[model samples]
Target: MNIKTEFSDKTLTAIIEGDIDHHTAKGIRETIDLAVEEKNPSALTLDFGNVQFMDSSGIGLIMGRYRLMKLLNGNLELVNLPEHINRLISLSGLFSLDIIKNKGCEQIETRE
Candidate 1:
């Protein structure tokens, strides 16, 4: 897995690519957490557009990040989710928790 982060306007965006499984989730979490602590962004956007596969570990990753953001008085957003990943989130019952702040946006647009 590969995770890239960008910070601006009090928001941190992480573009995650590849599969999110038990092996990769932990590394991704650590990387994101480091960025969050350094940037302290009011909002965090996890862009899953390039993610191809995900298991329960993905749910864990999301949950952990959600908790982290809340603890920091920030918010978390998931975007650009492909159909399979969306279904996983729904089936995992994450949506019921309202973890996804902006479900209307199919993708997070970035400024060049």
Candidate 2:
């Protein structure tokens, strides 16, 4: 998997590529965590436009990030999710916890 991160004053966006499974989850998690710790963004966005496959481990990664963001009193958002990955996220009930600002598109503010 390939992970690229962009940091702004209030947001950290991760552009993820390739499959997210047991093998790739650990590295992705660590990378994002490190960035979060260093940048301290108020929002975290995971862009999955280039991702092709995901498994249960993906859910774990999202959940972990959600918790981390909550601990920082921030928000977690998902963007550019493919259909199958969206289905997985929905089935995991992640939308209740994080914002799905866009699907395969740029992020938008959900609140005024």
How far is each candidate from the true structure, as Cα RMSD in Å?
Answer: 6.6, 5.8
lDDT of 1 at 9: 95
TM-score of each: 0.87, 0.88
Clashes of each: 0, 1
Best by lDDT: 2
* Whole-model lDDT per candidate: 0.86, 0.87
lDDT of 1 by residue, 1-95 (tens): 39999999999999999999999999999999999989999999999888989998999999999999999988898888877777778777788
Query: In candidate 2, what are the lDDT values of residues 1-112, reduced to their tens digit?
Result: 4999999778999998999999999999999999999999999999888898999899999999999999999999988887787778777888787488775463332333
Predicted model with the maximum TM-score: 2
Q: Candidate 2: where are CA atoms >4 Å away?
A: 103-112
